[model samples]
Target chain A: MLELFQGPLFISILAAMVRIATPLLFSAMGELVTQRAGIWNISVEGTMLLGAVVAYVIASSTGSPWLALLVAVLACALLSLILSFVTIVLKSEQFIAGLALNLLASGLTLFWFQTYIIGRDPPKFAGFEAVEIPYLSDIPVLGTVLFSQRVLTYVSFLLPLAVWFFLYRTRYGLEVRCVGENPKALDVKGLSVGGRQCLAIMFGSVMSGFGGAFLMLGYSDRFVPDLIAGRGWLVVVAIIAGNWMPFRVVGAIFIFALLEAIGIHAQVVGVSIPHHVFLVLPYVASLVLLAGLRSRTHQPVALGIPYRRE
Target chain B: MAKAFSSLIVGAFGSQKALLGSLAKATPLLLVGLGTVIAFRAKIWNIGQEGQVLAGAMCAYWASLWIGPLPYLIAVAVLVLAGLAGGGVLGLLAGVLKTRFGTSEIISTVMLNYIVIFLLAYLLDGGPWMESGATVAYHQSPPVNAMLEWPTLFGQGAAKLHFGFILALGATALSALLLERTPLGYEIRAFGSNPTALRFRGTDISRLLLVVMLVSGALAGLAGAGELFGTSHRLRAETLLGIGSSGIVVAMVGGLRPSGAMLAALFFGALKSGAIYMRLQSGTPAGLVSAMEGLVLLFFLCAAVATRVHITVRSEAHA
Candidate 1:
């Protein structure tokens, strides 16, 4: 067990954690923007599943991971329209709308999976390979853990900084924040609250789509029904546990990624505990994290409330 | 397609056996849906019905081990109580999380669900509950003691409806009464509509939330117990998992009313029952039903919003 913490095993685990954090980084950053705009979009899970499914389909059929990623994001964007209507347009309960979208995604995925993928041998896709940068990749442990990763992983690593910039340093970012904190002010300013929310939702869903696509094409060659599993929900938790801040949320995402990486490596590390304990750690941690945080000062004022002319 | 549709109808209702089977299926759904209806009516959103149901069955199974010798009637009664206690306790836990810690019930319930599911997987896979035999161990408990099985109401074979149907019916009536004729029910509805007013009116909002979770979780828990003791007669996660989500769907489709949930449960029960025959007869995959559920839910959500306001499709003539 002590050996698990030392030597090459620890390095490999850190490297794996970095790789695993890629999809979550893409998702958490996107959801942070949407939540900042005061749109409590919980449909991240469903959108992720749709993204994975589309990625699997396009990658196998067209033989282009890039094309698959594009189509997957596009598909999720289209699906977000349904959510936008039910949530932003109808002004219904945001949670309920989110739940409905999740159910729809899983049900549709099951149907499609059974209809096509069940009987036939699944088609193989050309998945993303790890790319090694020249000098950066040679920088000992730090270099291997950070520089030598798939292309998308590198993109995701820089996403949070980009998000922090977008959310804090940009004009539209302030408007988005205003829409969440005081939609009435935005409304008074003659800015369209619903329109801002719609775009935010679209962006959030698209990023989740990227996560799902990467989960499919970045690592695996085939797709399964539970591919996204609870990662989407984990992304939502990351947003909240991070107190809805850009960097803090990234911190939370890495924590989850680290736990999951350790869980995956526990058996190989010769731990005495049952695998289930490790598998369940992230969820158990989420409860404890939420209970301990208790700070809602940073939460958006109208996060889940549907905005309407009063 | 038409033939497949007809076959599905026949599979669900053509024979007395099929009808009884469908009713048996509806028992758990109705129970869980009733639990959902009350909670949703109050807008509590206890989405952990899945875990609650599992807890209920697990509790009842534990009770049976220690029950020892007793009269048949008393034994069954104890088991029923155990079932309720199991689910109610889990619900109360969520209630505490919300009332004390300020954790959102939505996130907490969902997290608890994963925890419970993992716990069960542990229990069944290699923990004490794994079915012991010469063959590879399945992730399930040994068949429930046959002597303790809930008595059948009527019919025979796989379609024999168990006594849980009666419990479910009684629960429906009780839920209707609780929501319509009781003060607590009034408080629940009022809480959903306006929590601030209820607080001003001297309601202990925390207690109300706890009660809501307890009742919602208990109802779902009962469904799990019913599925275990009354139908499957074995403790298995696969049999119990979908009932919670299906119940939620039933509650939503029923417009979060007791009577409406009953009808939706029956409809979905039939859909589920018929899916088997539909697959065999017309080669339509059963997964289509699950997909249809999502579509129906999305449709209903939109319809509720659409129906709430009088859309002025045509403009009034100018004077």
Candidate 2:
């Protein structure tokens, strides 16, 4: 355990944490916009998996990671329409609608994987490599941990800031927030409630898709059905534990990523605890965090409720 | 696609063996679906059926290890009770989280699912329950004692149906009664419709949540235990993992009604059992069944919304 904190190992751990946090940051930033718009879209997990599956297929077939990323996010964006339709047009239970999307996404992924990937030679694909910043890469531990990463990691780092500026500084952001805080107000202002929500859903879903794509092209070279695991759920938890705030959600995601990074390192570090303990750390932490953090203060007033016009 | 569809239909209902296999597969689904019905009706999203199912099987397996040579029926009963206790405790924890800590059941249940799955992996991989005598340890437990395996109702080999079918039928009837004819059922429906009114009536909503979760988890637990003792007869995560999600699909497509769940279970069970035959007949992957479950669920969701709209329009026209 003490050896884990030794200089170089500690820096490596921090680097791993940054890498793991990249995908989650993408998802959290996206989900925050959706939540702020009062749409509690819980289909992030399924959507992310769909993104990954699409990325895998496209990268394998077309031999272009960029094309895979573009196609995957676009597919996820289109898929969000089903959720928007059910929650917005149909006025069904938003949670159930999300649940349906989740099942649909995972189930479809399983089918496609089984039909194509199984009983065949694994497809080979080249994922993104680390792009080192010229001067910044030389700066001791911080450089390796922050500056030397896949190009997307930097975008994810700036994402929270960009989102913060949008939500707190821009008119459209204020209007989107209005849709969540009070949809009737936006509706009364002659702004379409469903229209704003639909846009927000697509944006959130596209970012989530990007997260999935990054998880694939940034690190993993192979496609598995359960590849997304519960990271998408972790993002959702991060949003809640962070109290729907942009930076706070990033903080929560980093905590989860840090735990995951530690879990990845624990066995190599000769930690005495069962590796399963590390595997479950994020989920356990989430439950504990939510149990301790009882405030729903920042939650959108109309989150998960279907809006109606009389 | 059409060939696959025809094969799926024939494989599901073509013969006595096929029909029995369908029922056998449907048993756990029916039990889990019935359990899902209870919680969903009250509008509490207990999404941890997967974990609850595993917990039930683990608990039952643990009990089986301790039980000495006893009357067969008594031993089986003990295991079943143990299964119920395992899943019920997990459900109760979620309920407590929702009521006491203000944690959402959805999040807590999802967390619990991961926790339970990791725990099972630990158990099966290396911790005590791992099967012995192989150079490489397979992630499964040694089969339960042969005497303790649930008795077959009919058929043999792959299509061997067990006592769980009877239990599932009884459960369907009980769920129908509980949701329609009883005061608790009335409260459940009322709570779903307007919890504020129920709270004003001085009802202990927390207790109700706890009860709903307990019953729901217990039913899911029974499904797991039955799957272990009746069908698989060995605890393997793969055998039990998808039943929970399929159960949810059943409950949802059944329109959250017990009888509807039964029909949906049988339908899905047939689809699953047929998938195996479909795999043999036309080289279709069994994973297609999982996709079809999701497809059916999404289609049902759209249809449900459409019908509700249709009914409202009709009522307005009548007025």
Candidate 3:
């Protein structure tokens, strides 16, 4: 156990935690916006998955990781448009709509992958490579752990702050927040509640797409079915655990990522515990955290409720 | 595309074998769908049916092992009961959390699915329940005693269909009756549509929620037992995990009605059955079937919403 915490091992674990947390951070920040705007977009898992597959397909075919990332975000934006229409325009139940979208994404990705790449050696591209900052990279522990990550990792670290500023510092952000807490007030103010919600949903989905792209282009070499796993759901949990706060949501994501890193490293180090037990550690931790912390966290008043003009 | 579509239709209904195969597939979906409908009717989102099914399967498997020496009919009955208890307990836990801790059933249920799946993996992967044969893989659980297996209801070979299909059909009728003819059924629907009103009338909402969870979980458990005794004969993750989610789609497509769920299950089951044939003959991937299911679910949700809402288009010039 003591050896497990030595200099190199500790730094490696910390680095792994950051990398693992990137996808979660991206999606959680996006979800934080959506939840803040009074919509619980449960389709984050599905949207992230769709983004991952699209990223993989585009990256392998075009050999441009940047273009793949862009396409991923745009494609998911379209997907979230469907969610927005259903939840906002049609006034459907958000949870069920999200579940339907999740299934759709899961099925669509698998079908596309099987139809196009099942038998062949699926094409692979060199994904995003890490960029080193000159002086920062020279710093011993922090350099290797934080400064030498992929460009996306650096963006992920800064995204929560950007979201924080956007939510707290902007007039539109205030309106969006109000749309969730009391859409009636916004409606009475002659503002379009549905329009604000639509933007929030789209923004959240674009972020989810970025997270999915990072998972494929920045983390893995190839795409697989169910590649996004449950990271999208973890993002939801983080939002709940963080009480819809940007910085605390990032903290929750880091804790989850830490558990995930431990799970991976435990297998690498041949820990005596059952591998499945370790695999489930993050989910168990999330449940425990949510159970304990949710009571203290105040969800938006209109979250999951469809707004009406009446 | 036309040829493939024709082949799918013919493959799903061309022969008795194909028909029975579809029925076999539909059995689990129907059972789980019934469970979902019951819970959804009460406005309870018990999305952890996947885990509850696994819990039931694991318990049924254990019960079969211990009761192997008993009379064949008695052993099967005991195994089914064990399955019900196993799944019901997990559902009850979620109910307790919701009533006591104010946890969202959706999140709690999803988390429970992961936890139960991991527990199943742990038990199967070189754990005590793993098959002991030299050639057997870690994932394979030991087959239940022969006496615990359900008797076949059709042609003897690969086309054989088990009696569990009858139980599924029976459950659909039973659930329909429970929802329409009983006071409890009335209360369930009332709770779904207006819980605050029910509370005003002095209804025990928490107790009602617990009962709904128990019944829903028991039906899902029955599905697990049916799969174990009728088809797989051994508990495995691949055989169980997707059933719960598919059941959710089935229930929604059925509009949360027992009779509707039964019909939807049969349709989806035919799609699943035909997808296998399509894969073998046309080289279309089996994943297409799942995609189709999702597409059907999305269409149904849209249709449901369209019926409930009145839409109007206005020019932006009005602003």
Per-prediction DockQ scores? 0.73, 0.79, 0.63
- Model 3 misplacement above 4 A: B133-138, B309-319
Which candidate number would show the highest TM-score if scored against the true structure? 2
True contacts kept of each: 0.68, 0.72, 0.60
**Which number leads on DockQ?**
2
By lDDT, highest first, what's the ranking? 2, 1, 3
What's the residue-level lDDT of B298 in candidate 3? Answer: 75
lDDT by residue (B30-58, candidate 1, tens digit) is 99999999998898989888899999999
What C-alpha lDDT, on a 0 to 100 scale, does residue B276 get in candidate 1?
Answer: 75
Clashing pairs in model 1, backbone N/Cα/C closer than 3 A: none
Alpha-carbon lDDT, every model: 0.88, 0.91, 0.87
Of the two candidates 2 and 3, the one with more favorable TM-score, higher being better, is 2
Candidate 2, A1-310: lDDT as tens digits:
6787789888999999999999999999999999999898889999999999999889989999999999999999999999898888988888887888888888888888888888999799878889999999999999999999999999999999999999999999999999999999989889999999999999999999999999999978688898988999999999999999998899889899999888889888879888999999999999998988777899999999889997
Give the DockQ-based CAPRI class for model 1.
Answer: medium
Model 2: clashing residue pairs?
none
On DockQ, the stronger of 1 and 2 is 2
Listed per model, the TM-scores of chain A against the true chain A are: 0.97, 0.98, 0.97
Q: Quote each prediction's TM-score.
A: 0.96, 0.99, 0.96
